[model samples]
Target: MSHPPGLDLGQLRSHLDRERPGLVGGPLSGRLIEGGRSNLTYEISDGTSKWVVRRPPLGHVLATAHDMKREHRVIAGLHPTAVPVPEPLLLCEDEKVLGAPFYVMEFVEGTPYRTAAELAPLGAERTRAAVLGLVDTLVDLHAVDPAEVGLGDFGRPEGFLDRQLRRWGKQLDASRNRELAGIDALQSALGRSLPASPAPTIVHGDYRLDNVLIRQDETDGVDRIQAILDWEMSTLGDPLTDLGLLVMYSARLELPDSPISTTASAAGHPAPAELVERYAARSGRDVSAVSWYTAFAWFKLAVILEGIHYRYTLGQTVGAGFDRIGELVPVFIEHGLTTLKDPKNSQNSQNSQNSSEG
Candidate 1:
């Protein structure tokens, strides 16, 4: 049997049998799971048991972007919390086993709901509940005390907003291959109008509907988030950044045959404002500065998408839908600019007022 690229069943079974002992009952069979644009994820089965494996993608990897240890650590820390995260099983840092550092976790059963069509079957009410649940779950995640969870040192939270802007700017520079209009302007605008971050908590760097597993409970027929996946970008940072990223994804991208997967167009999908209001009410954090954060989210995603597009050009990526990633970067940059300049942006207007008063 041909194992998926970046994974060897023989070495995996040997390592598991040695370290975990008796975890592997029968032969291992695995296949790569789709929809992940950064890390390479595979679903592995040992005839009786199933699990998921995660590792960095092949070639031209950005520094500190795909750390298996970091992802495993965050999930392990958040597993005990009310935050829905997959249970981490084993972490193998020894590259001899998988040819790269990798981690294993219990296979979570649920739908990621990438497109509106995927969510349409649940009806409007069910979709609304699921989306609201997304916000509530986020509140639950931000509510966790990082020190209590032993994640106090997960990331440097001091000056997080500025550092985040600089970090993403550097990432953008690293992936630069061609002229991207408005990207630099967006970066500069975000730096100029940085918002005051609340006390730092564990931030799910990429919190969106598609990054979580949603399963409808058979007994109650209520869609529930089973486990949150893809923690590669998680860290101890401004919690509002997560909310910002969520809000960015909540906005509809009007594009025909868009490469980016989004459920914002789904029937009954709550407005971004509703999600923000719910989060503010539940988390008790002032969201008045959310517009700036949302604009920053757009800029960050544009950089990330450009990085992916760069990787695709280098033939380093290992998935479909990458061919069109370049097309979305400009749109995201435009949104970032528009978000900051919009008269409805209370954050920007407030900042301007404060500056003038001072």
Candidate 2:
């Protein structure tokens, strides 16, 4: 069997037999799912049954951030709920099996549309419907009671917004390369204007249209969001933070030849106002403080992209776009400042954008 990078098929098969015997019917083959800049993911198969494996990136020494166990726990907790999540199968904490901790789940069939080009073939009407579906699904996700789903203790809700600002600040400092203008001002502004958060709920730290998988329904339209993938940052917190990120991504970003971007720049996508109104009407959540959240989203994404760029500078990253990722960080910082400075839709900073109960 051909082996994908960062995985040993023989060791994986042996571990599966010891942990989940009879799970595999034949030899296992695997392929790396590209485009993930954080945790590494793979599609593994036994020729009869297919599964997905998620693990930390190679040389990722921080176990807490890219923890497979945490991701598995969150997914399993939401399995019985209304949330559309891939069923968790097995979690391997032992690093000896795959050179890192990893988890397996049933392979879900759907499209995680990442770029405007990818969504173009679906046409304007379908693209518009698909993006709106993302917001509806988010409302559904935020509606779940953390305590009922056994996720009440997932994170610290009190002072969640404050801690988020400080945490991302430290993350930025860790990856500080060149002098980024307005970044300090944006951070200070966010710290000084922290708004009161709503009641706590499960927050999808990285909610976005591209992060979700969509499929066509019986009407032959993209109305169904099959699964909301990437739960590594799942936690309990103020839910509107999720909305802020959506707003940030919804902005029309014109980065000439920029490699890093979001699908919100696509045509036929709903305006930021429409998305917020939909959430407010359906979820009944107060989105007044959402502007602050969107600003924070810009800062958070800036830090993340900078980290990737930093790694690339050190020759530590592999991929086609890493070379150009650094160029996008300053752009994010600029947007962060702009969003926070806006009085009409100010939301404070937090990487995890949650929509709390209104």
Candidate 3:
């Protein structure tokens, strides 16, 4: 019945041996995987076979944000496809075992390069190829038919964009601690300028280089995208929303002593425009509407950071980065406003929509 800070190793071992015996070789010991915010990931090693365990954060819960069953289902569904996802093993909903529900999956061996410095050893050419490969892999994911993957009803895609806007606005209200000047204007503009969405696909709610594990050859050139981690924000929605977030994260921010992980500033990494163009050519989706999506991505991230910052103020958050989170919230607000002002992207989106209608 005893539990560690996040997981109870003894209870977890008993549950695993009972439910999925022979999965664990011996007694279990685990270390928490750092750098993750929403879900707590632990590398559980039974001194022989290793696996990864995912569960919701300690206290605060965003209903859809850190779902164990949802993540498990999506990964299991994608296991038969060409998409790279860890093979899900067993899902345990019994809270008595670990104080919370959790799931186990095969451990992926690769590096999640978070900063420009981390990718530096790969050399510039390899870095470019690695990042472009990330785009290529994304195209593969969108190409998947939801019905084919047994995830047709994963989410209600009707009015997905409107739902996203309202959802984030509500999130902002929930965590509002002080005055943020341009945030409300930016939200209002987004509500007024919602673009007509295309057909829905499984959207990786947060897609960036760091969210994936990239395995490299001995030459250090990127080999393959080993696995796409963190499916908590994933659902069936506008695929362009994924691209927008990728592009937004592709641009380096000027946050001093930033706690956020970003690899956009790395040399040999393509610009946001290049990534958009590649996705358009490959996926054959309209790229014009992406600017609005990217702006919205900023707003969503700002609200999320504010939530963390609010939790930090209340002493609910753990780890080193929470202290600097509030400092980055307003910066995200300003960037969202600036991104919306760019007529080239937003106007092009509207024009593209009008053309399609005509």
Candidate 4:
């Protein structure tokens, strides 16, 4: 089920003729961008203008999830708002055209940072500002009126948190390789300590630093967030969960027993607490209960990392990143365990209780 090298030039031209009408002309040139885990993306051009094409990965895809129509809808809904998202151009759900559903969007030009080391040249001040910009964007996103933005019906809002915990937990159980004692313990801990959440807000399911694109402006330092990539996981859910996941990936928590690096200087990232504080200040949202979110974040990450570890064990992926995933599993599990130790750290539960009482 390998994807076509790029947008099929002949088919693309034909599709343009019908849908877009004279937008794309002449032979098309395309370059593939690496590092996306789920979708197939390519930077395509006709030598004059550029565009991006997105389609499902080259293999069997779950029918219930990974729908191209949903991705297009999410991006399209965000375009009228302050959120920096790529503009969706065309959506083709007909499978005969590209072997699966596909969509095209304006090519957002900028550099994507995968590690803090890559951003080191910008110095701490500018890099921190850029990171804060992402936080601001998220604040604006959470503040948006989903009904006014035409995304109120995008996903199920009721019981979203419960569904998420159950869904990821099931995924972890189904993909386990060799018994992980910490995983079972963390699951039990999270289950018993589940928190209540406020009304569901739109959550970018996999928000992280790498998913944002940054560009340098000589006069004013780093400029605007050009675009937010990868909305496949966007949905109506607990917005704090998005913040928690960001902390899990971007924060440096103490891993006393693990050999992995625990500092920004060592692991090449900034502290998560600082980011959380920044978000709270800019958004005017209380983050005193963020610890529970952080714990849940680690739990979610551990499940994802363990799933990748299982794939690596089965010869699905070959690379240091995939191999190192197994080592990081225990680190994430430990974070979850530490968070669960205290019963008072239930951020979601408190929020739910407060809402119910109100």
Q: Sum up the clashes in candidate 4.
A: 4
Worst 10 residues of 1 by lDDT: 349-358
Once fitted onto the true fold, the runs of candidate 2 whose alpha carbons sit more than 4 angstroms away are 218-220, 343-358
lDDT of 3 by residue, 1-358 (tens): 3344788888888888899978888778888898785698999887887899998888746746677999999999998888999999999888787778899999999989999889887766777778888999899899899999899999999999999999999999999889998999999999999999999999988899999998976675446899999998889999999998998887768565678888765667776777788899999998777878989999999999999999999998788878999989888988888888983553233333322322
Model 3: per-residue Cα lDDT at residue 312: 94
RMSD of each: 5.8, 5.0, 5.7, 6.7
TM-score of each: 0.91, 0.92, 0.91, 0.87
Q: What's the TM for model 2?
A: 0.92
How far out, in Å, is residue 168 in model 3?
A: 0.5
RMSD of 3: 5.7
Candidate 1, residues 1-358: lDDT per residue as tens digits? 7889888999998988888998889999999998895899999998889999999987635638889999999888889989899999999999788878899999999999889889888877888899899999999999999988789899999999999899899999999999999899989888888888899999988899998899989999999999988888888999999998888887878788897888877778877777788899999999888888999999999998999999999997766689999999999999889888882652233333322322
* Model 4 steric clash pairs: 195-348, 195-349, 196-348, 196-349
- If the candidates were sorted by their lDDT against the true structure, best first, what order would they fall in? 1, 3, 2, 4
Q: What is the lDDT of candidate 1?
A: 0.87
Error of 1 at 308 (Å): 3.5
Task: Please give, for residues 233-320, the per-residue lDDT of candidate 2 as tens digits.
Answer: 8899989999888888877677765686566556676767778888999999788877788888998899888888888888977878
Q: Which candidate is the best by TM-score?
A: 2
Better of 1 and 2 by lDDT: 1
Q: Which residue pairs come into collision in candidate 3?
A: none
**Candidate 3 at residue 308, lDDT?**
91
lDDT of each: 0.87, 0.84, 0.85, 0.73
- List model 4 lDDT by residue over 5-108, tens digit each: 74575686678779998888766777678878788788888889999888887774684466889989988988988898898999999877777888999998
